[model samples]
Target: MKNRTIDYILRATWQAVSRMYNEEAIKYDASMAIAFALLSIDREGISSTLLGPNMGMEATSLTRTLKKMETKGLILKEKNPNDGRGVIIKLTPLGLEKRELSKAKVKRFNEMIRANVSDEKIRHFIEVTDVINELINNKTIFEK
Candidate 1:
């Protein structure tokens, strides 16, 4: 009660950041999910399988987002030449424009943070997150 927990701080900070992004996204008629997906897609196109993992999204969520993006004329899904059963996701011209907007917003946010926070603190924050990710990926946090 006297001290805040690590998870509490992480969750609260992320929620605030997420809210900020959502507010910015709304100005472009987008959601954070859509913006993130736009940024994740490659110019040459990416396999659906790879896209989902790269975006840290589940199949169902990614599928829904992709469908919405397709409806909005932001992306196109085409057969992957390398795999008969796979599809490649490519950004449309509009998608590319949206992607740039998303990129700019992210850059501005980071720039603001860097202007306020020392570089060393940012590096330490990244290191801590990397360690957290490694622990999660290695399944060491809950091992028997």
Candidate 2:
């Protein structure tokens, strides 16, 4: 059934994500890596709270990851001047370097996937994923 196929795809995606980043040994899980990647893409700082639900991560887990990253000098966390209660996370120079390396790894993974799957199928997969992402974003599937 179509639902089963989607479920399998989700499981496989998670497996691949976990395998790729979990071996880093830097306390960098897939979710944290993805969050760092997104921040790198944004180029500007982001609030810690905004990163949690978007990454399907809990606040406590995200806080722990941020702390680890901070200790590793992969990210800098500073009190938000506008809102003292809010913390802004930004990549340090070392963090940016790691982000660039992570981006390369992600690119290589995508290339491997493309090589294994036909272009047409890949396009369809991307379309379906986009639909799923839109649904998630709109809270049509999961409530934040």
Which candidate comes out best when scored by lDDT?
1
> CA lDDT, every prediction?
0.94, 0.71
TM-score of 1: 0.94
Estimate, for each residue in 16-53, the C-alpha lDDT of model 2 and write its tens digit.
Answer: 77765656524554354544444443457777767776
Q: Tens digits of per-residue lDDT for model 1 on 41-140?
A: 9789899999998998999999999999999999999999999999999999999999999999999999999999999999999999999999999999
lDDT of 1 at 18: 92
lDDT of 2: 0.71
Winning model by TM-score: 1
Runs in model 2 deviating more than 4 A are 1-5, 24-41, 130-144
Q: Model 2, residue 18: what's the lDDT?
A: 75
